[model samples]
Target: MRRLALVLLLVASGCRNGGAPSTEVAQPPQTVRNPVPTAYPSEKGDYAVTELVHGLEHPWGLAFLPGGGVLITERPGRLRRIDPDGTVSPPISGLPDIFVDGQAGLLDVALSPDFGRDHWVYLAFAEPTFRGNKAGTAVARGKLEGNALKHVEVVYQQEPKLSHGTHVGARLVFDDEGHLFVTQGDNRVAAAAAQELDKLTGKLVRIWPDGKIPKDNPYVGKSGARGEIWSYGHRNMQGAAIHPRTRALWTSEHGPQGGDEINIPRAGGNYGWPVVTHGIDYSGKPVQGSIGRSTAGMIDPAYVWEKSPAVSGMAFYTGGLFPQWQGDLFLGALAGKSLIRLELEGNQVVHEERLLTAREERIRDVRQGPDGALYVLVDAPDGKLLRISPVGR
Candidate 1:
């Protein structure tokens, strides 16, 4: 049904080659899930933002544990634990050697879905090689033991490492079916590799928890193609989250100068990064060989911000703490300096609002805690972890 909506949107926006009006209106997807309660208190200016922890260095990703604590990944290659009461612990040791270059370091952190029993913590970082001094995204897993990591193992690594540090996308997400999905960037200059199935760059890869490619993956049994690829033709996708009800995988990726986009990536779909973009080069020139928007077989974005927000991390709101925000989507903005909220009616974005605009903080990540509160990670030299809750609570 969401695919139908995309087709209808493309037709309505006259994004087709001939610009002919579409006759078929797509029907909305049936709401099989229970309806979300609509009593929204935060929309009435009844909420308060509290700084929970401080003194962190550019915290990138955040995930809550099954019990109470939170795990945070610092971009400079450190993992820290924050207790439920807001006490920050010493950095966890036994991490892989990471390249601490610009936008290349420890990126995302997530616990195994069965963390309570398995105690596996998965990490993705920019790994440096000694041969060519190049770096690429790598995934590893470790066991939590007090203040250190134990029994660490590398799960996956992008092949043919590149020398650039700007676009090493390393967002991690677990789908509803218990498979791990990792988003990789175009390595800043390898946009052509995005269309190549043999390379893992500029792709969404799905794998089993222990670094094995799923036998049922889209590209399995195909010769010369990586079996782990779920989708391709992505730029630098930094934020990803699975939908609460629809079970769709949504992503926010950085565009060149003005075309940051949000997409519901499809299996084996081409997102047309440098091929067709709403963005231009950093010097305000058009993308090379760009046709402005749609191409022959590439998919169009579900939503796009004409002026780039430098979108970083995103999550779907399903918690009851903010009833009005239920089923909505939240995305962190690095250059826009706010938390952007999207009101969704099915897969289509119906409305948008920017939060924390006045504070002017570059939001790095957004997560809904186990206790139903929203936790936001700020991007700064001295980053902060903030908890946003009701004002009079």
Candidate 2:
């Protein structure tokens, strides 16, 4: 039924009557996933914008190190490791050759669930296009060696890659059973590809450790589609995380001009993107009115920012550094140039507070470190690797 809604959206959007392919019109570039430029390291803000690490160019994704440190990935294909002492390690080798044009580049990174046992890590990155300018998103597994990736393996790659480079809202997370969840941006070109079961674009895909589509996935047993499909109707979802306790999945996605969203993902649910939006194109063209009349069967966002903040990374608070903030949802704002903390009283967004808005820095990612402290990555040439904790009274 959700797939049908994607079809209806394509039809309604003056795209086409059926899920047909257009030879001439390449899919929109992954505009939804592209990291927009901003004035990071804001000079003044409500919160103190401390600089953790500098010399980064266009940092976009982050993961905390085992100790008091962080691992940050720059869109230009460099991975820097920053220790709690503020020492920055050189770029880790063995990263895939990212298209690195616009939104395409080395994206999300995460340690293996049993990192203590194996020290393995996984990454979501875009590759040079197989056809046209379409660089496909792929997942790879490796170990962090001295200053490089070891035992690297490209577990999965999107097939029939298109010729566009945009909207690869790629994020990596693992379920309780150890299966990996990957959110692929719609390739920004193939909007209908979101509906086409044969293609992986604009889709939420599930795979085993080795990148094989899961046999028991919801879409398994269905015919004519990749069984890895966990859900559909997403434009470009960049943020993904599994609840440390509930085992539920949550995601953050980018909308066109205004309709950015945060969604709690359910298997087989459709998240309306171009079809149903809280926003329109940058041209002010009306793509959707409100969350009310999007394609039938599409799920509305749990919350939306009327003017897109271009949210990228998200982390739920589970640290002891701020006992008052435990269980809160924190998201990095790129276009909004700040860090947003959403207070929840059991799934109800009861409080909203904007941190570092005075700094006006483009926050690309927020994360909880191993020692239960908060870490944030700024996107800029002089981007800072920041640490947030409670100020002792």
Candidate 3:
């Protein structure tokens, strides 16, 4: 039905679906409409979407503690710790001032894999002003003392901090080798960085734990580009996860018109940004590469949304809670207002289903909390903290 809606709306309105303006339609805005889905459409969940922590100003990143509780970061430059029992810890101190303009601020927070012994948390954020108006993406290490971050030190900083914060794609994953993989969106201010080898914008980078550039990164020897780049040509990467068993790094990124992409970021892979896309230009103008033309060197997306569900977060389901969901992919959608579950066979997506669509809510993030339940944070004022566990046995 989702695919049918896009075709019908496109045939009717020429172009439609997503937040694209009518005048900017690559074709014309389609007027196709479809009924939304529901797990329990008759009524809201009998269980409360419950408030884990209130008073947070636009929280972005969420990480669960080993013993108990979770930590979240507010975009306005504060780190908070919330206990499962609903106790909100005071804001942690020692964060550097950020260039909090539009969409830029303190971002993704995750504890170190060695946290049990290290007592440290890792963070990504917009750095203090640099190059006048632009600011860099910074990764810092801070010690957790009681409820505050102490002995904070930035381990990595992406260059050309002058780009106004548009794409701060900061998701952290620790590879089996203990190296860190970090994703950064192509800060709208810099488009060329996506193709540039040395620059960090619009790229997924790999680094050593202490903030050192990994000696084995693909572009370490490339001149003019930063050394941490694992892949290039990405625009606003938001969803990323290390596959449960394959350990291959897969990422989901936002595209302009209809091309949102799921890519495997191999060393030095070029993902075809402005040069090529499945989507048309936002202005409805022609951009490079027509749809589905078997490009030579460039990698094709594993899955794409013609209607662009505006993907945000994703993870591979390995838990027994949703036995049917095992080995599938769970994705959060913003514009489509849905939770997309992609049925996969190896690297191929066989089928896709929506868990939440009619709600018209923007889902920002999804993760497996410490309690072994799937947790999702909606991106709205009525933003909800939904604990998606298996129906009680």
Ranking by TM-score: 1, 3, 2
Residues 1-393 of candidate 2 have per-residue lDDT tens digits of 000000000000001111122121122111111122222332122222234445556667776545334456666565655443334454556654556667776677776878768877777777665333557778877877676677888898876566255887788888898889998887866666776777788888888878887778878888887788888878888888776668688899998888888888788787876668877767777753334436678888888888888988888888775677778898998999988888887655787777878678898888876656567878876655665644321
Give the alpha-carbon lDDT of every model.
Answer: 0.77, 0.67, 0.66
- Give the alpha carbon lDDT tens digit for every residue of 38-131 in model 1: 1223344565566655666777888777656667777766676554333445556676677767888778988898888998888888877754
Worst-scoring 10-residue span by lDDT in model 3: 5-14
- What's the residue-level lDDT of 292 in candidate 2? 41
Of the two candidates 1 and 2, the one with more favorable TM-score, higher being better, is: 1
**What's the TM-score of each model vs. the native?**
0.87, 0.82, 0.83
lDDT of 3 by residue, 1-393 (tens): 111100000000001111111121122111222322223321222211222333345556667777665666656565654443334444555565566656777677777889999977887777655333666677887887765567878888887564565777778878889988888887876666677876778888899889888888887877776788888988878888889879998898988778888988899888877566777767787654343423678777787777788887787878765666678887788887877878889999998877656556677777875455566767753344556654331
Better of 1 and 3 by lDDT: 1
- On the 0 to 100 scale, the lDDT of residue 94 in model 1 is 71
Q: Clashes in model 1: which pairs? A: none
The Cα RMSD in angstroms, rounded to one decimal, for candidate 3 relative to the true structure is 11.5
Return the top candidate by TM-score. Answer: 1
Which stretches in model 2 have alpha-carbon errors above 4 Å?
Answer: 1-49, 83-87, 288-292
